[model samples]
Target chain A: MAKLKNPRGLEDSQVMKMSYWKILSILLLVYTVTGGFLMEVPRLAIVNETIRSLYFHVPMWFGMVVMFLTSTLYAVRYLKKPGAYFDIISVEFANTGLIFGFLGIVTGMIWANYTWGTPWHGDPKQNGAAVALLIYCAYFVLRGSLENSEQRARLSAVYNIFAFAAMIPLIFIIPRLTSSMHPGSGGNPGFNTYDLDRNMRMVFYPAVIGWILLGVWIATVRIRLRNIEDKILELEYEKNH
Target chain B: MKRIISIAASLGITFTGYAQEPEMADGMRSEGKIYVVVAILAVILFGLVAYLISIDRKVTKLEQRLNDGKPR
Candidate 1:
């Protein structure tokens, strides 16, 4: 691996390298897709074979939450240190998070249609997730509206923090408070020994980890591309001046 | 004759007992066709990951080019 100097005097780790986690992500996902379909799932009455969706669908939300959490942390870092690097990281993470969230919602709707009798059940958890994604979408809008790079970074950093805060309660807390059709909410028995039993956890946990790593890898690629763009712009300005 | 008749009846009972299990894709698996599906999915996953890796390599090359004191 060539040692590339980060444009902003950031640590060497900030410079992207082919890491072990990327390999792990690939391996885990391969296992998940294979095992998810073939493995013996609980023969639940309503879900039956569709219960396999748990391995695929649930990971998207888990990956999204992880990405958003990382974004919020970087946003907080930007507030304290005030650097373009942190801001870039924050935005790219949120971008990947949004992708995961969209997949989560789409896959969820498909699974719900067969199990819940409708695509949009207006379940508390579903609404909460939709509301949470909208809040993050507004974060991007907030960033786009500002012209100045510094101003855009600063304002969006604050908004990112707020968005994460709202998402926690909306997606996690509110669903539990209200009677949600979702499992593990509103006194419904979650995927415990009953549903997401020991057999499923073997695949589900790795699937979540694998997907989160994949999301991070994607965000890092975007961040690197953005860095290249910034460097080109800086070099161009220097040449002109 | 009675013994042969009892064996036939027990065979019929066992077949029905086997049918009582929860319906799964056991037929597909028993016929060994599910491996085809697994192979197809694995190939797709590997293909996407390989593509992602290539993009990552391209970005790394760009980073190296810029860091080499040459502006592309």
Candidate 2:
């Protein structure tokens, strides 16, 4: 039996061992079981009511933040290494991050509609998130418009770094300056004191971990698929030439 | 055309009647629209889950093909 070589020169066994999805599935299973049990308990109903969205929404934001941070790291590494693999990883992570970001927005809107008056109030947090999303959207558009791979990677990396730097102030800092209907508003305590209790933390922490792992898992799968597609395209081009 | 006009005329009168003194029940009726919104969102969520499952299967097939060294 012969082993196939990965394009990056890693062995097939190594690739098989790198299954983030399997780990994520296990984490998700644990979360579902625990969350279900927690919801059923009558004593924690008050804590669980509004905080339930925290499990879904906070995890999404955590995943998005992690993805963007990881992509930034990869972008920097790509600039240093000048490799296609890093570029692919960065791009795939960005794409996955955007998916989670969009989910976060949807979940936040639904929660807000129930808690606030409207689905979308002109809140600073909402506007900041929208801007951050648009910046990432432009990053993809910039990549699409570029003809050369190296140029695309370079320009996109630069843009990724800038967008991420801007995102920090937009999503986190600037939102803190304004009066927001959402939690963690101006001069208000955030996720501290009475906001998050022990019971809520139990599920909330795990939810963050589970969702971040899931995001990474999804990004890894996307990266693998993209790598394969690139290899196939290269092979076809070689054959044609 | 005349029948359509009469129907429109009657609807217009009915709307004017309600518009003059929009009853408190109309508030409840508008609030009921939230249920419709929730239902639509539920349907969308179901559709998204279904689509995601399909995508997962496709990805599995693609991965298997890649492992087998088949062109796709």
True contacts kept of 1: 0.31
- Candidate 2's C-alpha lDDT? 0.72
Q: Weakest 10 consecutive residues, lDDT, candidate 1 chain A?
A: A187-196
lDDT of 1: 0.84
Candidate 1 per-residue C-alpha lDDT over A41-136 given as tens digits, one digit per residue, 9 for 90 to 100: 775445657778888888899999999999999999999999999999999999999999999999999998986779999998999999999999
Q: List per-prediction Cα lDDT, in the order shown.
A: 0.84, 0.72
TM-score of chain A of each: 0.91, 0.85
Per-residue error (Å), model 2, residue A196: 3.6
Task: For each candidate in turn, give its C-alpha RMSD to the true structure in angstroms.
Answer: 9.0, 12.3
Q: Which digits, one per residue and each the tens of the lDDT, describe model 2 over residues A155-189?
A: 99989999899988888888778666556655454
